[model samples]
Target chain A: MAFQILLNIAIAFIWMLLKNNFTGVEFAIGYIVGLLLLFVLRRFLNFDFYFRRVIAVFKLIVLFIYKLILANIDVIKIVLSPKLNIKPGIIAVPTKLKTEWEVTLLSCLISLTPGTLSMNFSEDGKTIYVHAIHVPDKNEAIKEIHNSFEKAILEVTK
Target chain B: MTEIVVSILILLGGAFSILGSIGIVRFPDVYGRLHAATKSATLGVICIIIGTFLYFLLVQELFIGKLLLTILFVFMTAPVVGFMVSKSAYNVGVKLWDQSIQDDLGKAIKKAEKKARQ
Candidate 1:
């Protein structure tokens, strides 16, 4: 709990430094105030497992950075193609994960990837429907989501 | 030199956004158009935010935190919005063009119906 608060303060400091705003005194006072508010909220909400969630968020940041670089390359290929060589369609990808947060993260990841967008999820939460922009192979798309994003999400949440 | 790069990125981002808007107008169906709108528009906004960050970084020798915050916010929100729009469009009975192959959702619906009756 204390560790999480410290981590949040460190992150806030870095963010403030990057922004080139706030002097030393200002940063210290602001951080302490923010940390107090956060701690109060956490206690009021009875969020005992916040540390694990924070770690998961950190992992997600790293994963997102890696995906962002790959997505840029994919989008470049998409833009430069002479013919709009796209076989666009929506695919119903089955979700093996159970939690709402895990499912939502998977959908967001699919959408973030250059060639894919999460179209919908079934009411029962059994499947996610995604739209692929340039699906040369349908099976490949489904497999990618199932193995890549969903697999990572399962690891983080469960 | 830094200013030149920033200008170029800004121009490119604007161009991508314009192309995305054009796609929304030109694409045949709701799904197809949403694809264009979501992908290009999201990328466009990202690029613009990145360019702005770079501009500030070059001038001030520090990153702008809000740029990352903007990226995070867009990354979170854009897809959910896109998903909602597409789902609503589909639910409202927007039909795909004749050329579209493999209606997987339709097949799934049929299979579910068959199972439900039995």
Candidate 2:
């Protein structure tokens, strides 16, 4: 992914030099040309086109921000109510992420999202111990993690 | 127009910060407190930083790379701090609130101990 980005930038710079136009717009045009060039020659490339991963990563960030806002709203509601009613619990959230960075990102997102904080990972790294402010149904919390952050992460990494 | 937007963002950030403080004071346990401290505070900082970024971009007509970097750094590190604090607290045997409904980690620890015995 990093190499593809560098290659794209290099193509943009070369285009600028050829056109004798060194502005941002000329560079953007070059970038598009480079993107097309890469796309046409993608079969020979060792990995997937960089834009696919880039788009996936963009989607993940959007999903993360959406979740963060939603969770913050939920927290506000819980905090403002006159009655203190919450079912805080430590649940063993099973994860399918294999890579070290994948697991780390998942855990970090879990800690940031909703009312959950990832306390620790199990010995085998298959499960993360998460402390959630509200877990009325354990299965629901687990499913939320799996379907949202974990799925988004897999899209980005795999 | 820029002033209105900046003010609103700053107010939102300030409100979240106050809410986070209230949560810290009201929550019953360390883990719960971690949630309050980490999520709301991080959001608060992000909001304030964004507001400042906008202010500098529009009012001062300068793009400050440092503000964006600050936002990124905080967003990345806040969770790690929360994770570390809660993990260390757990390691020291800090008790959960009485009202907490589950303790899956305890069960996992017990299972590990049972496996070790065999």
Candidate 1 structure, TM-score to reference: 0.69
Model 2's TM-score against the true structure: 0.94
lDDT of each: 0.73, 0.92
Off by over 4 Å in 1: A1-59, A62-83, B1-5, B53-69, B111-118
DockQ score of the complex predicted as candidate 2: 0.85
True contacts kept of 1: 0.37
Predicted model 2 interface RMSD: 0.7
Poorly placed runs, candidate 2 (over 4 Å): A1-3, A23-25, A40-47
Write out the backbone clash pairs for model 1: none
Q: Give the TM-score of each candidate.
A: 0.69, 0.94
lDDT of candidate 1 at residue B63, scale 0 to 100:
75
